[model samples]
Target: MHELSICQSIVDSILEELSALDPKPKRLISARIVVGEFRQIVPDFMKEAYKAVTKGTDVEGSELEVKTAPIQGKCGDCGWAGDLPMGDFKCQSCGSSGLKLDGGMSLYLDNLEIEK
Candidate 1:
């Protein structure tokens, strides 16, 4: 699944960042990730992928916390700004399809807890 590749990328980044530290962490404790609704990433699948990928790594047994952000957009025609359902870019107030997405469709590591 794509989640496997995504987890691998996350692990690679974590390792690279850890190596750059002055002393480097002995082990990773947990990780916090922010995912937008538009990203469509299944949290359970991601957790499973992470567990499988991290199996023999320093981050093994580490907790993964995922936070989801709502999809936000602004209507270009009526200046309506608010949350919207995923994939529905239409403005609720003005019934306009001309909308500008402001948030969602984002995935990023928020924080890492490590032990020295």
Candidate 2:
């Protein structure tokens, strides 16, 4: 699963940043991430991946907090714009298929909780 690689990347990035700090953190508490619905990431899989990838690493024992991000879309037909329901590409106002979607495709670390 790609979650493993994603977890590895997160760990690598966190460790790199932690190393640059003047006062290193005593413990990593959690890594909060936003998982867009459009990305179709399984939270369970992500947690499992994090557990596997973090073993023996500096961030080991840290939790992975996942948050779901809604998909936003604009209807070209009705000029409507708002957050769209997942998998529903049509506009709620006009029910048009001419919807331009944004967001909900991202996978990024939102923040890190560390004990200093």
Candidate 3:
């Protein structure tokens, strides 16, 4: 699944970041992440991906915790703001298809638990 690649990227970036630490971490315990609903990520799939990709690596056995945010949109013309259904970008109240997505398009590792 595509989540495998995403998890792999996370591991790679985290390794890069950890290299900057004054004393390198000995083992990774968990990774906390914020994934937006607009990204269409399945949490179960992502967890599976993390398990598979972390095998034989320093991050093996690390837990993946994901927090999801809603797909929010803001109407430019009528100032309407609320959650929007995926694939339907139109403004709910104004019915004006002119809406801008304010958030909910992110997938990033927020924090990591590690042991020295």
* lDDT assessment of candidate 2: 0.87
TM-score of each: 0.89, 0.91, 0.85
TM-score of 3: 0.85
Q: Residue 49 lDDT in model 1? A: 87
Q: 96, model 3: CA deviation in Å?
A: 1.9
Per-residue lDDT over 1-116 for candidate 3, one digit per residue giving the tens place of the 0 to 100 score: 67887888988987777777778888878988889998888999998888888889777888989888888999999999999888898999979988889668888889988898
Q: Write the residue-wise lDDT of candidate 2 on 1-116 in tens digits.
A: 78887788878887887788778889889988898888888999999998988999888899999998899999889899999887778999999999999888888888888899
Candidate 3: residue pairs that collide: none
Tens digits of per-residue lDDT for model 1, 1-116: 77778889888887778788878788889988888888788999999988888899877899888889888989889899999987678998998999888669788888889898
Estimate candidate 3's alpha-carbon lDDT, on a 0 to 1 scale: 0.85
Give the number of colliding residue pairs in candidate 1: 0
Judge candidate 1 at residue 74 and give its lDDT.
91
Clashes (backbone N, CA, C under 3 Å), per candidate, total 0, 0, 0
- The window of 10 residues in a row where model 2 has the poorest summed lDDT is 13-22
